[model samples]
Target: MLIGELAEQAGTSTRMLRYYEAHGLVRPERTANGYRCYDEAELRVVREIRGLLAVGLGLDDIRPFVACLRAGNPSGDACPDSVAVLRRKLAEVDDYIDQLGAVRRQLQTQLAHAITVRPR
Candidate 1:
């Protein structure tokens, strides 16, 4: 199929598919007339990539999962590399939550102090 067909099947836009190709995430071949051609399997790959991105995973973090898929695994996260990447991401998320929690507490304390010190 061509890029448009693949995008339709994947429920995404051709522009997004082109972006994926540009980022080295998808490798579509050129047709005789220089049009991009893709296999049907790419539909699944594109969907997987979108899902990962929606969950805050960057393309660099998704590389291992893509590699596992390209290696013929049924699931992209079925490889050790993918597992390691996920673990690292999990830790990062935890740290971010902690940082946000501290910020939230500070904001709450400031609001309380403002209310108490306001003129009647």
Candidate 2:
């Protein structure tokens, strides 16, 4: 399919698809007329890329994971490096969640205090 169709099927914009290509995430074939054509596999990769991005993984960090998937790694866990990457990402997510929780607590306290304060 063409870029627009692929984007629609992947729940993304053509601009994002182009950005993914630019980032070396997805590589679609070029038609003789110079139009980009995406296969089902590429579509799947695009979906995976979107999912990774949604989870806060930078494109650079996702490269190895994507490569492992493309290389037909049956277990996905077979790649020790990918496992390490996942662990690192998990740690970062945990830290971010902790920080966000602290921010939420601080906001709640400030809001409670504000409700008790008299307006001048």
Candidate 3:
């Protein structure tokens, strides 16, 4: 199928497919007339890429999973490298949550202090 068709089937935009190409996330074939051609498998790749991106994963972070899928794995994250990437992302998210918790505590303290020291 063409880029537009693939994007429609994948429920993504043509611009996103182009962006995936630019970032080496999806590899489509080029026709003799220089048009991009995508296979049905590419739809799966696009879905995987979209799923990861929806969870805040960047293009760079998705490369290994893409490679794993291209390598014929049933799941994108089935490979060791992809699993490691997931682990790293999990740790980063945990750290972010911890930081957010601290910020929430600080905000609560500030609110309490203002309540106790409000000007008449």
Candidate 4:
């Protein structure tokens, strides 16, 4: 398939695919006329990149996963580097959740005080 077809099938924009290529995440060959040419396997790779981005992973963090897929793994997270990234991301999310929980407690305490003092 071509770049446009890969973008359409992967539910992403051609511009993003090109961006991925520029960032060294996705590498497509060039045709004789200089048009970009993609392999069918690239569809899976593009989808993997999109999923990682959606979850707040930057291109740098996604590199290992892409490399894992390119190395013939069925899943991007199959490699050790990919697993390390996932573990780090999970820890970050946990910290964020903890911060949100603290904020929620503060808000609830304020609401209770306001309700008690301003009864109407």
Candidate 5:
């Protein structure tokens, strides 16, 4: 399918697909007429890329994982290095979550104190 159709089917924009290609994430074939053509496999790859991005994975981190996946690894965890990368990402995410939770608690406490101190 063409870029527009692929983007429609994948529930993304064509601009995003082009950005993915530019980032070396998804590679669609070029037709003789110079139109970008994507196969079903590429569509699946695009979905995977989008899913990874949604989880806060940087494009650089996602590239290797995607490459391993395309190389027939079946699972990112199947590759030891990829597993390490995922572990690192998970650790980072955990730390961020902890920090955010702390900040949220602090804000809520401050808000409650302010509410008690002032009538509004």
Candidate 6:
């Protein structure tokens, strides 16, 4: 199919598909006339890329997942590199959660103090 067909099937914009191509995430073959030609396999690749991006993964972080898919694995996260990236992202999320918890505690303490010292 052509780029527009792929984008419609993938439920993404053609611009995003081009961005993915530019980032080396998806590669579509070119016709003799220089038009991009994508196979059915590229539809799956585009979906995988969109899914990863939805989860906050940047293009650089998503490279391993795309590579995994291209390697003929049933799933992108099946490879060790993709799993490593997942682990790192999970750790970052955990750290952010901890930081938010600390901020919540501090806010609670401040609120309590303000209530206790307010003029009657």
Candidate 2: residue pairs that collide? none
TM-score of every prediction relative to native: 0.90, 0.76, 0.92, 0.96, 0.78, 0.95
The residue-level lDDT of candidate 1 at 113 comes to 97
The digit string of per-residue lDDT tens for model 6 on 81-114 reads 9999999999999999999999999999999999
What do the candidate models score in CA lDDT, each in turn?
0.91, 0.86, 0.93, 0.94, 0.86, 0.94
Off by over 4 Å in 6: none
Error of 5 at 92 (Å): 0.9
Clashes of each: 0, 0, 0, 0, 0, 0
Please report how far candidate 3 places residue 87 from its true position, in Å: 0.9
lDDT of 3 by residue, 1-120 (tens): 999999999998999899999888888999999999999789999999999999998888898988999999999999998899899999999999999999999999999999999999
- Ranked by TM-score, the better of candidates 4 and 6 is 4
lDDT by residue (1-120, candidate 1, tens digit) is: 999899888889999999999899998989999999998667778988999998899999888888889899999999999999889989999999999999999999999999999988
* Lowest lDDT 10-residue stretch of candidate 4: 35-44
Per-residue lDDT over 1-120 for candidate 5, one digit per residue giving the tens place of the 0 to 100 score? 999999999999999999999988889899999999999878778887778788888888787777777887765446776677789998998999999999999999999999899976
Q: Looking at model 2, which ten-residue stretch has the lowest summed lDDT?
A: 73-82
lDDT at 93 for candidate 6? 96
Judge candidate 5 at residue 20 and give its lDDT. Answer: 90
* Global CA lDDT computed for model 5: 0.86
Give lDDT: candidate 6, residue 95. Answer: 99
Segments of candidate 1 deviating more than 4 angstroms: none
